[model samples]
Target: MRTPPQRGRRQGRTTSRELILGSARKLFAEHGYAATSLREIARDAGVDPAMVHHWFGGKEELFNACVELPADPAQVLGHVGELPAELRGEALLRALLTLWDSPAQPALLALLRNVTGSKAQAALIRQVLFKRMLALAMAGLPGSAAELERRGVLVASQMIGLMVARYLLRAEPLASAGHDELAALIAPVLQHYLTGPLPGTGSAVPGTGHG
Candidate 1:
């Protein structure tokens, strides 16, 4: 009988990538984003530091890859985009609160925790929010570029502050309140951020300040 051919040893390349990502996620969750370095992740994964850079390019990219959300932010916020501009803010706030209250709460909390713990992670979070969430949410709204930027920043600040208060800190009332209740309380502020008058701009925005 002909001798059986020897199978090649498993290269384990994919395993290495998985290991890196797994380590990154754990470290990011535990130590926050800025404090967790590529070298530490590689060491935790039993891989070389170079492997991390090879796999993820840099810490920012690695953080992005590791921080996977349970839902698509674009889709979650898309309904707000679909609504009339005047109505978008409350819908957006309601939708955001509902998402955090859902099964994805843990992951959302984790991301928020990581963001609070590290400035680097905070920067990464801002980038992701602006690129993925706020950009879509702000689409087609009437404003100069500067006005739009200010509005987006204000909206994000409100949402982030709410998340920190209600979810992370578990502040009473807000923590226990239902989504609709919280949304009702917070949506008007967000509406102002979305379409309200700016500090110096004299131009009036149509469909704004109506509700």
Candidate 2:
């Protein structure tokens, strides 16, 4: 049989692990992926530095547990290029919209809502959504790799803007719009960001739409 001190130590270890997980979720929801650190999480959990490393491998693994990405955007998006050219925009938009509209949305929205209030949270959101999600979506386009990356970034910029308007700020029209309506209005713009010619390509353009 274990000694009394050993039983007490086991109970203490379980409690500490719970505390660490709780703190991690709150900090990740509040700050973001890139900004939160194991040390900071440890401090918040009121545990020793080594405890965090003992319980969770590192920040990345901790994030995977806390945020729980439902689908791997990198893996999901890799096949975007395989769709018929005309259908690509709709397909991509549908994928994103479906993911966001599902039950997973609450956690994602909570994270986004907290980002403006916490630097770490914003960093985390950016890395997950832009760096990982968009990077995977834009891979292997017919261009230089840098160009493809830039296109991915640009696409992210547009999507972020749309999300802010629709979900964050709750602007009129966009706020009231249903997912299908929003998708119709936004998918072509995303298409341009993904596969359209570069901005300086030989074309004269006139603009007439606002918002």
Taken over the whole model, the C-alpha lDDT of each candidate is: 0.79, 0.71
Local accuracy of candidate 1 as per-residue lDDT tens digits, 48-113: 888788877898778768766667766788777777889988888888888987899998888877
Give model 2 RMSD, 1 decimal. Answer: 6.0
lDDT of 1: 0.79
Relative to the unseen true structure, what is the C-alpha lDDT of residue 206 in candidate 2, on a scale of 0 to 100?
Answer: 42
Expressed as tens digits, the lDDT of each residue in 1-211 for candidate 2 is 3232222587886787778887887787666656678899999989887777777778766776665565566556767756665556666777776776777777667766766756655655666776667655654557777776787787878777877777678898987887789878988888877777666643533464697
Q: Every model's Cα RMSD, please?
A: 8.3, 6.0
Highest-scoring model, lDDT? 1
Please give the lDDT score at residue 80 for candidate 2: 71
Residue 205: error of model 2 in Å? 5.4
- Error (Å) of candidate 2 at residue 38 is 12
